[model samples]
Target: MRVLVTGVTGFLGYHIAKDLLKDGHEVINFSRRHTSEVDELGIETIKGDLTNYEDIKNALRDIDAVFHAAGKVGMWGKSKDFHRINVDGTKNLVNAMKEQGAKYLIYTSTPSVVFGKDEIKNGDESLPYPKKYLNEYAKSKSIAERFVLESNGHGILTTSIRPHLIYGERDKNIIPRLIQRAKSGRLKIIGDGQNLVDINYVENASHAHVMALKELSTEAKNQGKAYFIGQEKPVNLWDFINKILEAKGEKPISSKVSLKIVYFIGLIFELVYKLLGKYDDQPPMTRFVALQMGTSHYFKHDNARVDFGYSPKITIEESLEKIKN
Candidate 1:
């Protein structure tokens, strides 16, 4: 099979492309910039933007499957920007897939799409999208997921995989930022430190994408559906952070702040940032970040497993050990 993976420079994208190559598939990396890593792997490269229909159409040529993993992800961003990249970009991909007769599309989505300022322990795919989104990123992603799933027929097999708190080796965003904040004495527990959350090991998350692509079809159960992919069990959010800190030779986060106070502070920061026209600057905190840290939002993976034989090939212990070393 010939596979096209967008955002191949990203950690998860890189993993997906690598796994495809290992399985004896022709891999084409789609990204705006070239990286030495991709060149060294001898994978074909396509330079393009997801927001451009022609660019995406060109990349879709001779592609049997696609992993649409590119998006602007963050707690803070302009609504228009988020919509353009996440929502509009996905629409472009869907159109290109249709134009070129691509059969399978496995979209990378986030569980935050259903976040409604509440705890969601053991949630499943049946959960509805939130009525009010606290962040533009989530809102845009929800719209994008809908577009992808709705464009299911007409010889296109599409499914969305929502992976929570993806982290592991070569993680450029999540854990690295946490460690940086911890080293700067700026990290604090937002709640009572009892919130549970599901996290995806990079390998497992990418493996799920491959499984979905292989099993997806017009008559397949996974077609047009969404599945939550993560570790077999949920872990305490702060406890998992502490484990990573320990691996990095840093002491655990001991300082604590009330969720209510932090949420109020986040609102103030968001307002000030928006007022000052500092779209490029990071907010001190955001309500979405506080809610994510202070609540339990783990999900069950039975749907993914039953639909496509999705399983985490790497254990959490093994993943942590790899990071530790």
Candidate 2:
């Protein structure tokens, strides 16, 4: 099959493209910037922006399926900017897929869409989207994901995979940001650091994407459903970080800050960034960050396993070893 993967230069998209190629599928990568790294892997590359309907439509020509992995992800940003990239961009993609008569669309969503001030323990897809989102990123994703799922029966087979805290080799988000803060002596554990969170390895997360696409069908069970993908076991935030630091021969982080203090500091940062007109990018800390750091948000993957036969292949220990090396 011929597949077009948006955001192929991104962390998860890169792995998904590689996996597709290994499975003997013709892979075409769409991105704003052309990179020789993915090109060297023998993927056909197209430079395009997701927001532009023409660019997206051109890339869909002759494509069998689409993996919509591109998104605007951040804790802080103007609501309009997030809407343009996440919601409006997704609308454009869906419209293009309809015009090109694409068979399947597998959207990569986040579990944050269901998150709020309360803990989300053993939550499933049956749980409704939050009444209010903490940040623009989550709100936009919620809106976009709704469109993707609703477009399932409209001549397009669509499913969404919500992977939480994806981390592994080639990760440029959480791990690197934490290391940078640690080096700057700004790393502080929040809320006693006992919150359990789900972290998905890149390879396993990529495998979930492929499995969802392979399982796509006109059946109601396979159509218009979203699944939460993650490791089999949840890890305590502090324990996981300390283990990684110890394996890397770095000192384990011991200092801590109360959730109240962290929340206060995040409020200050939000106001300061707004006052400074720094809305183009994310602020150092935001309300969403505080909630995520201090709250336990894990999901039940029973639906994914039952609907798509999806199970994580890599163990947490194995993932940690790969990261350590």
**Maximum-TM-score candidate:** 1
Q: Residue 150 deviation, candidate 1, in Å? A: 0.4
> Model 2 segments beyond 4 Å from truth?
217-220
Residue range 1-325, candidate 1, lDDT tens digits:
8899999888899999989899899999999998998887789889999999999999999999999998999888789999999989999899998899888999999999999898998999999998999999999999999999999986688999999999988898998899899999999999899989999999999999988887884347899999999997899999899999998788899889999999999999999998999888789898989999998999999999999999899988888888884
Q: What clash pairs does model 1 have? A: none
lDDT of 1 at 290: 91
**Which digits, one per residue and each the tens of the lDDT, describe model 2 over residues 98-173?**
9998889999999998887788888889989989987889999999999999998798889999999898888898
Summed over model 1, clashes come to 0
TM-score of 1: 0.98
The TM-scores of all predictions, comma-separated, are: 0.98, 0.97
**Candidate 1 local Cα displacement, residue 312, angstroms:** 1.3
TM-score of 2: 0.97
- Alpha-carbon lDDT, every model: 0.91, 0.88
